[model samples]
Target: MSGFQIGKDIISYVALGDSFTEGLDDPHPDGGNLPQGRYRGWADRFAEHLAGHVGELRYANLAVRGKLLRQIFTEQLPRAVELRPDLVTLCAGGNDILRPGSDPDTLAEAFEAGVDRLRGAGADVVVFTGFDTGFQPVMKHLRGKVATYNMHLRAIADRHGCSVVDLWSMKVLQDRRAWSADRLHLSSEGHRRLALRVCEVLGVPVEGDWSEPWPQVPPLPWREARQEDLQWARQHLVPWIHRRLTGRSSGDGIRPKRPDLEPLG
Candidate 1:
């Protein structure tokens, strides 16, 4: 366990954002029982860790899949404020970064407003920057946009006295294993490691390391790799583009899994 500590006990935590916060692709046994397909993501895992430390933790996850920063700022922020949580984690703007013609500066401004409001309500806030996507075959083009957004997010975190989980520097996440089959959300193991990282950022005591290396595997043959890429584009990328063109979101009509701050299991 790391010696670093936040010192302040967190009794209530409210998470706000999109699919990453919503825990997409990290399926849990009981996930189907929750609202919005509710796969257990890093936020839920983080809450569980805190519960282990404090013996009681009230947690709420207001994130929904495919939400842009503006939607989160408008729909989730007010509810988070009403909860009056002791801790808040915001990880929005990712979907916005993926959209064509989206401006990172404008998104950052909206994000900062939410952070300031949460901090003003006396809650310790945590924010996450996007990961370095240079290694991803389909996502490399968006790397610059992600980097730009990360810079703005870091500045906002500093301005608001908020904790920052700098995913851009997390080398472990560069592994292909960290991503799901769709090449969008993190896999279950990836989500687990991310939870560990968040705990580390908060200075919370943790038993395991997120940086443990994955077992090595032989690289795919050139033909096989090309085939996989084609399949991914067909199964995931095309649908995503369709959604964008149709002005529809994957989160349409979906509700948060854990909308109310209730004791963590």
Candidate 2:
């Protein structure tokens, strides 16, 4: 797609959603006191791109890891509206979809509501479809559910005049290197590519292509694969299950790293 020209008047940008938008697993050594990681995702990268094109830019990221769609709508959406940014990127619903018995239709209804609200506030809204996880051995089962949610997201974006970054269609992400060890979050290179992809959708100029291929690697042995599965279950899956059972979230007491729309330094 060709880059669309953004008006010079557009300045403030706010990002809302969960870990994906929060830039998880893409560590920043100087994350300060933020509960999780630092703010360095596609949102921040987009803001930097905007700043380069338009001079000064104000940006805020209200995303936190482990936030469900409902929580994001109830908590972040209101604040985003209050901020009245010129641009808002919303990438929620993944957390909800991963949960057992979550309904895509129901989730879409809530998601569309937030998009409508952001549009009503006169901000350009951007939404993301969930990635296809069929290649992941443990996450393959959720492919159907993710597909359902992605379908809903596209319809919602169309209805609300919001732009969408179609993650499910990005074949490059099928590479195992695109994902972190937990198979939940994106790796640093993955985040870089994701940023470029978002910029492409937004008609922003980017330095590189997100679809660039990675170096080839040999497949792991069967025994190694099995061992890795056991390790993953022990290190990530079990903890996630525990958190769910105890009614806890990774973002329990975390606050937004950038709560206000200010100059990006």
Candidate 3:
């Protein structure tokens, strides 16, 4: 990837991906309250930050809650091209890699092809590496796969001259507070920090710092932590597995929050 050069004027930007990009757990704040069904994920926050720098930016988010990589290819890619945005940010394949028997190599191959299409569309593309799963009891098992995929992502970015956000190297995300109760989606602070990271990678001037240290708090006792894990397993993990088994999706009836590029104001 050539990387996001400074002073690039991104008049229009679009984001493509799954639940992580959909901002599932992060409720967009309304005044002082956080209303349900309102999500402003990292991409949205980054869009706002970008608008502040570039001025009069139009942004659209095409990410759904449970899309696989192939679905993103078939669904989001064509629409993204049609938009002909000045910049495109894509963070997909996490859902695919979480499934059983999924092959990172095959996933990377398809991912590379998608990058090619976005670049070919004449948009400066940004891609993300999967976060380190080392913090999760279940996901820690997939560390090797995540690492392999991350390697491929860096290589792909290099080949295509794209800007890259390496989540695998973000130590701030390793903290439990950065995650929501579901232990799947990120919390509000997490999204904000990620937005800062995006600005840093893009060489854009943003208000906050992503590397700010987490507030020091006493760690949860082993008993409480395990209890939380069990609860998450029942509430989130089980439901996710059920969907996989039944071929259902959280995004089944849901539509993109921002289907068209709208002025950020």
Candidate 4:
């Protein structure tokens, strides 16, 4: 994708997605989740990268954590189209795939519609395929569904003439350090790496290479690994299940960090 370009005088940009877009684990100040646009995920990072190449870029991130694909389409997509940005980046439908009986084909249909609308509005849209989840524990079971959806996403991108940041091919993300303790979201390093990847997709020059390998580290012993998995189950997995059971969402009252396109500094 080195030759692909959305970098042609992109004056405005909008990002739409869920937790990953929201920067869940990649806190701005390098700590826990903070409010008031502090979660500078890959979108923000990528916007900054663009700002370096262009001038006076207006950026908006209408991505709330835990948002379902349908919710994003009905809720954020309209606002994104309304923003009329020169560029748009979308990565949705992960939460839906996590559900018990979700269908990748159906989800892909909705996703393609959203892409079509954004493209129709004249924005240079960029879509991402979900990361290969085989590295995670229980979540790895959804690999087939994610893979299927990724193929759909690639097809949709081709059909719609949109750029694609294929996260499924980012083999570097398979490392444990790329993920946070919660095991659902990426760490700051992961977000940074993803930012560089998007820069590659858009043909924008950035300071770093995302594919650089991580430094060597000893592997955790079996007992310690097992303990960590148990802790994750107790901490992250259980709450997620409970929220689903109670019809609640992590982003229930959360609003988009940057609802309107604002000029970047």
Candidate 5:
């Protein structure tokens, strides 16, 4: 399946990544038994659009929330290989950055390991989704972290003969209207925007209308605070609360600095 030409034959794609790839905080459209946890991320949108353009193209999503690069290389990559995918999309590394006190070198190594393993497994087209650090306030320090990882990713993709999708350059994160309220995850509209990016990168015709209302954003199933939950409340919500108290946006109030990100390569 890996060597199958995409234009000549219908392709089979497998998506492997973390929460964004898994559609975390997005509602299931069908609302079936497991509907609340259905695939609603960019990968799903990419598959839907790719299906309409190609014949008999099938997709399998294997993205999990909070997945580290080590786990992806050690576990997910092999399983994805077993499926023998013609096209593969990967959107990992957020968890690695979000982890406590993570260094660039460590994250870079883990990321490269996954890419090496996947390329060795015969994936024809390998797409790496870039990081979107603009979504979270706390991610300010981790902006360069993505570039560090992507540099290695691009190098590996070139050496191994694969393609890459630079999500970081899309600037979707800078548009607050495109993001969810918490400023951590992508809204349904955001997912659609992401689907378009994937289609353009892969040279596949987009399937559905990009203007449609997307699947609703779902609630987090697990308990615990994300970096955004903490920083968003601190920067935005706290200032709003102070405004309500003092009835003044003119006066000095709590202000948090946005994280600095490296320029897109």
Candidate 6:
């Protein structure tokens, strides 16, 4: 791992996906305010891990809630292209599968289109992610949907010459402790594991657990905040706080700053 030079070569990374990629269940220090929507997912950990590997690289996450294959192509992918990212990681299709009318054919087409658009925009390496069907309620119900989506995703990525992270079959998914109460989003420890794996996929070196040690500080004003409420804060509040903290606008995890589409752009 030390022999690898990813630290010297890589710079920007843009993550595009659904709720899991957004880090829905992960807790936040600011009363769960950072994720704005599921903002604390692996993408956030990936960025922090990258900071350790590389210095001064831009990390952007454009993952959204309930986003489908088509939405990513029309919306998220375009914005990502504008960043001119060096590496692009996508973890979509979970929400598409959970949709009432979701069908494999429609999803396959959308994934293909999104991949093509990203390649056209000159992303050097695109890392794709698969669903963890066995770990969640909705995914368990649609287990078959995961295979169908991955089949298409793998085929498209192969044709385009890109890499993928098969989270569905990864051992991490088997651990109950890896997920949050929702059984979909990752817990803090889960996020740490995810960061290590994603670094391996990107051919980057990983060190440490990458988990944010729970601060000894007092808890948030509220006793509790669920995933849905956390998601709301992710899209609305986190960016505001990031701007305040750094005097620059950005989301905590993979989500990026696009003032052009502020107010949930």
Q: Candidate 1, which segments miss by more than 4 Å at Cα?
A: 1-10, 32-36
22-136 in candidate 3: lDDT tens per residue?
8878887662453347598898888888887774788999999889999999999999999998889999899988998999999999999999999998889998999999988
lDDT for each candidate structure:
0.87, 0.85, 0.88, 0.88, 0.63, 0.64
Error of 6 at 113 (Å): 1.4
Q: Least accurate stretch of 10 residues (summed lDDT) in model 3?
A: 1-10
Question: Rank order by lDDT, top first?
Answer: 4, 3, 1, 2, 6, 5
What would the per-residue lDDT of candidate 5 be over residues 47-144, giving only the tens digit for each residue? 67777766677677766655666765665677778777666777677666655577767766666676667666777755564565755565666777
lDDT of 6 by residue, 108-149 (tens): 777777777777777754555565566554348787777877
List model 2 lDDT by residue over 1-265, tens digit each: 2113466755788999998888887876466754544757667777777777775688999998999999999889999999998888889999988899999989988888888888888888888899888888777899999999899888888777788899998999888788888989998788888888988888777699999888889999999988988998999999999999999999998888888988887
Compared to the true structure, candidate 2 yields what TM-score?
Answer: 0.94
Which wins on lDDT, candidate 5 or candidate 6?
Answer: 6
TM-score of every candidate relative to the true structure: 0.94, 0.94, 0.94, 0.94, 0.72, 0.71
Off by over 4 Å in 6: 1-10, 29-38, 135-138, 208-265
User: How many clashes does each candidate structure show, in the order listed?
Assistant: 0, 0, 5, 0, 3, 12
Model 1 Cα shift for residue 185 (angstroms): 0.5
Candidate 5, which segments miss by more than 4 Å at Cα?
A: 1-5, 132-135, 207-265
| Shift of residue 244 alpha carbon in model 6, Å | 35
Which candidate would rank higher by lDDT, 2 or 4? 4
Report the lDDT of model 1 for residue 51: 86
lDDT of 1 by residue, 73-105 (tens): 899999999999888889999898887899888
Model 4, 1-265: lDDT tens digits are 1123444564888999999998878777733554654688889889888888775789999999999999999999999988888888899999999999999999999999999899888888888999899988788899999999999999998888888898989999999999999988999999999999988888888888899999999999999999998998999889989999999999988999889999875
Off by over 4 Å in 2: 1-5, 29-36
What is the C-alpha RMSD, rounded to one decimal, of candidate 1? 2.5
Positional deviation of residue 62's Cα in model 3 after best superposition, in angstroms: 0.4
